[model samples]
Target: MQRRANVELRTAYNAFIESKRMSDPASGLTEIPALNQTLKPHQHDIVTWALRRGRAAVFAGTGLGKSFMQLEWARCVAEATDMPVLILAPLAVAAQTKREGEKFGIEVKHCREQSEVGDASIVVTNYDRLQKFDLEHFAGVVLDESSILKASDGKTRTAIIEAFKDYRFRLACTATPAPNDYMELGNHAEFLGVMTQEEMLAMFFIHDGGETQKWRLKGHAESEFWKWMCSWAVMLRKPSDLGYPNDGYDLPPLAIEQITVGVDHDRAQDTLFVMQAATLQDRIKERRETVEERCRAAVEIIARKPDTPWLVWCNLNSEAELMTKLIADAVEVRGSDKVEDKERKLLGFTDGQIRVMTTKPSVAGFGMNWQHCADMVFVGLNDSYEQLFQAIRRCWRFGQTKPVNVYLVAAETEGAVVANLHRKEADAERMAEQMVAHMQDITVATIRGTSRTKTEYNPSVEMTIPQFLEAA
Candidate 1:
C-alpha cells in the first residue's frame, strides 16, 4: 500500500512539472515552402523559425540582413495566406524597404492610405500613416524598426498593440530592443501577445523599491525568463551568437574621438567656478551656452574632409540651424519639415547628392543605412544612450569598407553628460553580453529545430510513509 501511494505521488508530481513548463504554442505553418534563395544560412534559419512561431521578433544587430529576412518572411506569409502583408517603418525607411524588396525580387507596394494598398501582396507604409489604413485587411504585419513602438507616445504604442493583437502573423525587427532597460522587453512581449507586460513583470520581476518605475529580475527567475524569451524571440549581436560563421557579417574598425570645446566660465552665474553639469537642466544650459563652440568644432571636423560624405547629428533646433549655416554643403532635415521634403533630403544624402547632412538623431537616426559615409559628428547629445548608439550606427554599421570615424563635440561643462553616456554604454554592453550568454544555446537550438527538455523528477531514495502515519 505504501509503495502504491508513492507511485501515485510521483505521477502527480510529474504532471505538475509538465504543466509548469514554459513554451508558446505554435500557431504558424508546420510545413513551409522554400524561402528566398538569396538568404544567408543564418537569415534563412531565422526566417524559418519566425514563420513557425507565427508571432515573433528578430532582434538582430544593425547590418545583419534584417531587411532581407523580414522581406522574405513577408513574401512567404503573403503567399501562404494569399493575402497582403503590411510592413510599417519609420519615416523615409518605407522607400528604402521598397528598394530592398526590389533587389530581392519581391514586389513591395509603398502606400499612404487604404485605397492605395489594393491588391498588393506586400505593402510598406510609414508609422505615421498607420491610421490611414484598415488593419483588418492584412494577414500579417511587420514593424521594421519596432523599437519605435517604445519610443512613440503611449497612445500610439497602445493603438499599435491593440490593432494587431488578432493578426495571424506578426514580426518586430530591431537592433536595440532593450539598450539599458530590461523592462522595455515587456513591450515586444506584450505586442506579440506572448504575455501582457504586467503578467511578465509578475512572473519574472520584483519591484526594486525606491521608484515606482524600477523593477529587476527575481533571482531565481533569470533562466526561466530567458527560456521564455527564446520561445518567441531571437536576439544576437552577430551571426556567431547563434553558432554561425561571422565571415561577411564582421564590422569594420570603428574609431570614436571626443572633441571638447572650451566653455566660457563667465557664463555660469550659479557658482564662482564653472562645474560639471550635474542635472538635466544644467546639461541643457551648458549645451545651449556652448552651442556655437560645439558647432564650430563640428564644422572644423567636416571641413578637413570636405569632399567626403559626413553625417551630422544634433539635438536642438539651434544646433541644427547653426551647423547647417556654418557648413557650406550641409543640408538640414528638421522635425517640422514636410514629409516629402524629409524623404527627398534623406534620399538625396543616401544617393550621394548631399555631401554633408545635419539633423537630430530623433529625425534621421533610426533606419537609414549610410555606409557610403564613414564619418559622423554629434554636435549635441541628450542622455539617451539608445539614440546616441543608433546615431553612430548610421555610419559605423557593417558593409562600410573604410574605417568609420565618429566625433562627439561637447563643451567642457558638459563632461558629466559624456561620462553618463559612457556609463550607460557600459551597462548596455554588459546587458547584451548577459542576454547573449543566456539565450545563445536556446536560440541555436530553437533555430535549428531542436526542442528544450525539462528536468525530470526522479525519486532516488524509496519513498516510505512515516511510521506514525502508517500506523494511523
Candidate 2:
C-alpha cells in the first residue's frame, strides 16, 4: 500500500510539472506552507491543552490561532471517545470559525439553522442555533469568545447554560474572558463545572471591605485559582508567553486626528448619562443633541479625510441609523447583516477597494481581519474587552507594517466602558505573566496522558515533574 501510494503521488507530481512546462517553462508551484507552521509559543501551549480530558480553557489572545487549537483538540477528543463535538459561538463568529477550520484544512460541518446535524464529529453553530438543537449528543464543547456569557440574562448565555448542564468536556476560549468584572469569569468556570458560580464567588472573589458593598476584584489570586482549577484547561497569551512575529505584519502608516464631542453642544447633548430606567427617558431627551452632533461630526470627519477609509463604531442604534442615511456611500455592517454581505464588505475592505465601512465593534470584531485600514476610529465603546481586543487586532495583525492607531472618538459620558477596556488590557498582561511563570508545569500537565477528577489531580505514576499549582 505504501509503494502504491508513493507511485501515485510521484505520478501526480510529474503530471503537474509537465502541465506547468506546457504553460510557463520556468514556472514552479512550490508547496504552500502549513497553516499552523511557525506557531507562536502560546500556540504550542494550546496543542498541549487539548490532549488532556475533562474541561479546559485556552485563554489565548487574538492572532494566536485559538480556533486551530480548539479544532485540534476536538479532533483528538473525537478520536478517543468517538463522540461528536459541538462548538457554540455567535452567528457571525460561527461563520468565522468555519472559515478558520477550512483555512487550516480541517474537515468539519457547520449545521444549518434548525437542521439536524449528522455524524460529523465536530459540529459548529451559533448560540441561537445551538439553543434550537439538542446538545447532549456532543461529547465535547467549545465556547469561542466565551465572554458573551458575562450577561447572565442574555438569550445565548441562558440557552448555553441550560443545554450544556451535564457537559463535562468543556473548553472556553477567549483573550478577554472577564472584561467588565470578575463576575464574568463565573459563567465560564461554571460551564466547565470545575466550580459552580456559587463556589467561584465564595472562593475567588471578595467584596470591598468598605461600609458599602462596592466590588473590588482580587486579580492574580483568581488567576491562580483558575491555574489550579485548569490543570485539564490551559490559559495562553501572545507576544510574551507565545512569541509570534509581532512586527511581521506590514501595516500602512496611520495618522489619526482625535475628535472629542464636548459637553457645550446643547442642553440635551450636554447631558450624556442617566442613572436608571426613570432617567432612561431623560437619557434619550439628553441624547437628542449629542446624537445629532455626533452625526454631524461623522460627516465632517469623512468630508475632511475623504481619501482614507473611515470606520465609525457607534453603540446606539440612533447614531448608526442616522449615519447610514447621511453618508450615502457608506456601508454599515451590523450583527443583523446577512453573512455573505458582511463577509463581502470585510473582504472589500481588506482587498483595498472599499474606503469607508461603518460598523459596531460587536458586529465587525473577532476573526474578521480588515488589515487594510490601519487607522481605526472608535465612535463608541461598550462594556466588553473581547470586542475591543478583536476590533483593534483587526489592524494589528501579521500583515500590518505601520503602527496601528486606535482613535477614541467618544462622548465623555462613556467613561465606565473606556475605563473597563484599560483595566482588562492591564489585567490580561498580569494574567499573562502569571501564566508564563508556570509554563513548564502546565506543559507537563497537558502531556500527562491521564485525566483525573479535581480531588485527585495527582499524576503520581504518570509523566515527569508532577506538581500542581498549589504545590508550585
Candidate 3:
C-alpha cells in the first residue's frame, strides 16, 4: 500500500512540474500557406516561422533581405486575416520599402495620414506619422526598424508598445536589439507581449547592488532566459547562424582608417601640455574647435577617390555646413530640414544622383541601404557606438562588391572618445556572440519547425516512500 501511495505521489508531482513548464502559446496560424516565390530560402523560412509564431521579432542583420521577409510576412498576414496590415518604418525607409514592394509585386501604399489608407491591403508609413492612423483598422502591424522602441524618447516608445499590445499579428525587424544592454531586451519582449519588462527582470535577472537601474541576468537563470527568448524571437547575424547557406550573404572586407588631425598645444588654456578630452562637454568643445582641420582631412580622403560615392556623417550643424561647403557637389541633410527634403536628398544618394552625401547618423543611420557607395567618412566621433555601427553598416553591408572603406576623422585630443568607442564595439561584439550562441540552436530548430520548449521530466533516481508514510 505504501509503494502504491508513493507511485501516486510521484505521478502528481510530475504533473505539477509539467504544468509549470515555460511555453509560448502559438497565437499564430497553424498552417502557413504558400509564401512568395521570389523569397530566398532563408528568407522564406524566416517568414514562415514568423507567421507560425503570430507575433515575433526577427533580429536579422542588415542587408540579409529583412525588407523582403517583412514584405512577404505582411502580405501573407493580410491575405490570411483578410484585413489590411500596417508597416511602420523610419522616415525615408518607408519610401524605400514602397519601392522594394513594387519590385516584389506587392503593392505597398505609402500614406501620410489615416484618410489616405483607405482599402489598401498593405500600407506603409513612417513612425512619425503613426499618430495619424488608427490601430483598430489593421489586423497586423510590422515595425521595420523596431529598435526604435528602445532608441526613441520614452514617450514615443511607450506609445508604440501601448498601441500594439493587443494586435493579432506583429513583427519587428532590426539588426541591433540591445546588443550590449540586456535590459533593452525588455523593450522588445514587452512590445511583443511575450512578457512585461518587469516580469522578465523578476524572473531571470538580479540587481547588481543598490543601483536600481542596472540589472544583470541571474547566473542560474541564464539558460532559461534564453529558452524563453527563443520561444518568441529569432536572432541571426547571418544565414549560416541558422544552418542556411551564406552564398550571397557574405560581407566584403571592411577597412577602417582612423585619421587624427593635429591640435595646437600652444592654444591650451589651462595647461601647457595637451590632455585627452575626458568629459562630454570637453569632447564637444574639442570637436567644435577642430572642425575645420577634421573636415579638411575628410576632404583630402574624398579627393583620393574623386569620382567615388562617399557617405559622410557629421554630428553638428556646423560640421555639416563646413563639410558640404568644402566638398563641392556634396549634398547635406540636416535635422532642421523638412521631412520631404530629407527623404528627397537621401533617395537621391541611394539612386546615385548625389555622389557625396553629408548627414548625421541620427538622421540617416537607421534603415538606409547604401551598398552602392563603398566609401564612407565620419567627420568626427560621437560616443554612441550603435549610431557609429549603423552608420558604417549603411555602406558596408552585403551586396557591395568593393571593399568598404571607413575613415574616422577625429581631433588629436579626442583619443578618449576613440578608445571608448573601441571598447564599446568590443563589448557589443562579445555580447552579440553570446546572444547568438544562446539562441542559435533553438532558433535553427524553430525555423525547421521542430523546436520544443517543455522541460523534459526524467526521474533518474527511484522514488522511495517517505519514512513517515511508511511508518503510517
Candidate 4:
C-alpha cells in the first residue's frame, strides 16, 4: 500500500510540473522582425529575445548600449502592436535617451506631463511623474534603471506595479542587480507579474540568521530558482556572454587608493581601547567627529590635480560645502537645489564646464554617464555597498580612456566601515560569478533560439480503479 501511495504522489507532482510549464503564454507572444543594420549582433539578439518573451528584464552592465536596445525594442513593439510605448527614465537621462533615439532615426518625444505627450510612438518621462500619465494610452512600458523600485520607501514601487498590472509588454533594463540584495529582483518579479515578493521568498528562499536577517536561496532550490528566473528575464554583463564578439565592451582598469587621516577620538569614553566599530551608533559617532579631518584629506588630494576633471562624493552637507570652498572652481549640488539647477550642474560637469562637482551618491549615482572623468574621491564611506559600487562605476564604466582612480578618504577610526566595504565587494564579486554561471546556459539557449518547450506527456501504464469506490 505504501509503495502504491508513493507512486501516485510522484505521478501527481510530475503532472503539476508539466502543466505549469505549458501555461506560460510568453512562448506564444508575437515575434517581431529582425533589428536594423545599425544594431550590433549582440544587440540584435537581445532585442529579438525580449520581443519573443514580451515581458522581460535585461541586466546589461553600464556602457553596453542598453539605451539602444531599449529604444529598438520600443520601436518594434510600437510597430507591431500599433500602440505607443512609454519609457520611464531618471532625471536628465530622459534628454540623453531622446538624443540617442534621434541618432538611430527613431522619433522619441520627451514630455513633462501627459498633455505634452504627442503623436510620437515613443514617449520618455522621468519616473517621479509616472502618476501623471494615463495608462490606457500605451501598449508597453520600459523602465530604465529599474532598481530604483527597491528603495526604502515602497510607495513608488507599489505604484508602478499596480499601475501597469494589465500592460501586455514590459521591459526592465538596468546594470547588474546586486546579488546580496534579493529585494531588488523581487521588485522586478512583482512588476513583471511573474510573482509577488512574498511568493518568491516563500518559493525559493530561507531566512538567514545573520545580523542582516536577509533572505537567501535554499541550497536545494538555487538551481531551480535561477532556471525559473531565466524563463522571464535575461542577465548579461557583456556581449560575449551571449556568444558575440566583446570588442569595445571591455572596461578600463580601476585603481583604488585609501587615504587615512588622523582624528582625536577619546577611546576611553566610547570603549576600553581603540577597536573596530560593531554598531550603527559607533559608526555614526566616528563619522561625525572626524568630518573635518576627512574633508581636509579629500581637499588636499583634489588640490594636487586642479586642472583635471574631478567628481567628489560626500555624505554630509558640511563636506560638500568644505570641498567647494577648498577646491578651486568646484561646484556643489545639494538636495534642496531646484530641479533645473541640479540638472544644469550635472550636465555641466559631464560636458567639461564644471571642473569639479560635489554631491552625494544617493543624489546622482544611478543613471548618469560620466565616463569622461577618471578621478573621484569619497570623503565619507557608508555601509551601503550598492551606493558605493554605483558611485565608482559612474566613471569606471566603458568608453573611459584613462585608468580610473578612486580615493577612499576616511578617518583612522572609520577603518571598520572601510573594511566592511571591502568584504562586501569581495562577496558581491563572487555572487555575480555564481549568478552569471547559472544564467549563462539559459541566456545562450534563449538568444540562439534553441530553448525547448514543454510537450504533452502520456503515461504508458494502464491503471484500474480501486475497489473501495466502484461506480454507483
Across 1-472, the per-residue lDDT of candidate 2 in tens digits comes to: 6556556666776566555321101111122112255445455445554444446667665556677888876766666677888887754567667777788777678776436577788888866566566666777788887776873366666667767767656778875554335566667766766566666566556777774434544675655564555553455444444333444324346444456566553434345543321344543443554777667766776676677766777777777888878887777777677766876776667667777778887776655655566666666555556666667877776556656666665444433434555677788667556555565355443433344434222224522332452244
Which ranges in model 3 have alpha carbons more than 4 Å from their true place? 1-24, 210-212, 416-419, 443-445, 448-472
Give me the runs in candidate 4 sitting further than 4 Å from their true place. 1-23, 27-29, 208-213, 265-273, 416-418, 443-445, 448-472
lDDT of model 1, residue 250: 71
- Collision count for each candidate, in order: 0, 14, 0, 0
Off by over 4 Å in 1: 1-23, 268-272, 416-418, 443-445, 448-472
Candidate 4 per-residue lDDT, tens place, 1-472, comes to 7567757767876777567543335531455676878898878878888887777888888888899999999999988888899999877788778888999888999888889887889999988878889879999999998888875377778888998988888999988688778888888888887777897888789986786547889999887777777667777778776667899887888988889887665754766766655677887788887788899888889888879999999988888888888886999988788867877888888889999999998888888889889999999877789989999988988788899999999777666455677899999888777777766776455664624222224557655445452332
By TM-score, the better pick of 3 and 4 is: 3
Q: Which window of 10 residues has the lowest lDDT sum in candidate 1?
A: 450-459
TM-score winner between 1 and 3, please give it: 1
- Per-residue C-alpha lDDT of model 3 across residues 276-298, encoded as one tens digit per residue: 88888988999999999999999
List the candidate numbers ranked by TM-score, top first. Answer: 1, 3, 4, 2
Q: How does residue 29 of candidate 1 score in lDDT?
A: 72
What TM-score would every model get versus the actual structure?
Answer: 0.90, 0.71, 0.90, 0.89
| Displacement of the residue 34 alpha carbon in candidate 2, Å | 15
Give model 2's TM-score versus the native structure.
0.71
TM-score of 1: 0.90
RMSD of each: 3.5, 16.5, 3.4, 4.0
Of 1 and 2, the candidate ranking higher by TM-score: 1
Candidate 1 lDDT over 293-352, as tens digits, reads: 999888888889879999999999999999889887889999999999999999999999
